[model samples]
Target: MGEVTEYVAGLHEPARSSIEGVFFIAREVVPDAEEGRSYGMPALRYAGKPLLAVMEAKAHIGLYPFSPAVIDAAADLLEGFDRTKGTVRFTPEHPLPEEAVRRLVSLRRDEIDAAIGRRRA
Candidate 1:
């Protein structure tokens, strides 16, 4: 198993399932995303850029897309979830909707693509 899969597999109940759910949605959205570490957290990387990272905290789960702009773009869907400039915290009891996760991965993928395009231009 990969580091990410191993990481998730090593977690305890509920947390494991919760992170797994996010990983499932992420894979569907970006099948080419690679398993890697970003900011010391296991993350999904697309086009050589950080796509997203999901981690379980003592009190809540954190979804880090690494872009404050992306968070702002999905602010409506994130209502009621505790968040900061770079992280969204949710609980397994109120896990992030698949749609939100999809949007985040898609947006970040798009951003990475755009940046690469710009660099080539």
Candidate 2:
């Protein structure tokens, strides 16, 4: 987005915007989270560990879902696109599917609750 930062740089606008959207939804879904930059991308932390991270790649942008629940919920969206537990790769030419984005955020909220419940248990 901008010049080389102390934490994150080497990112272009398309990737930067994609990361920004991911961060926006993540914050809405995971308020109270500690947000920061990691490896030149946005990272969301809960309980002192990574809950999610976003990065833009040359061919695609990656939205990393740290929760299995989010992946399962978005299985259909992953049918043809590149994917991983820590990444959902897509392109700036074709924006990440909006429905998929909402699903991810919804699932993440559930995952956070479940993890909190597990910790309490």
Best by lDDT: 1
Each candidate structure's TM-score, on Cα atoms with residue i matched to residue i, is 0.94, 0.70
lDDT of 2 by residue, 1-121 (tens): 3221311345568666666676666677667667665455557776555666766566777777676667877989777777776678887676667777768766765676676774322
Best by TM-score: 1
Clashing pairs in 1: none
Candidate 2 Cα errors over 4 Å, as ranges = 1-10, 37-41, 118-121
Per-residue lDDT tens digits of candidate 1, residues 41-77?
9998888888999998999999999999889888888
Q: Candidate 1: minimum summed lDDT over ten consecutive residues — where?
A: 112-121
| Candidate 1 TM-score, C-alpha based | 0.94
Per-residue lDDT value at 116 in model 2: 74
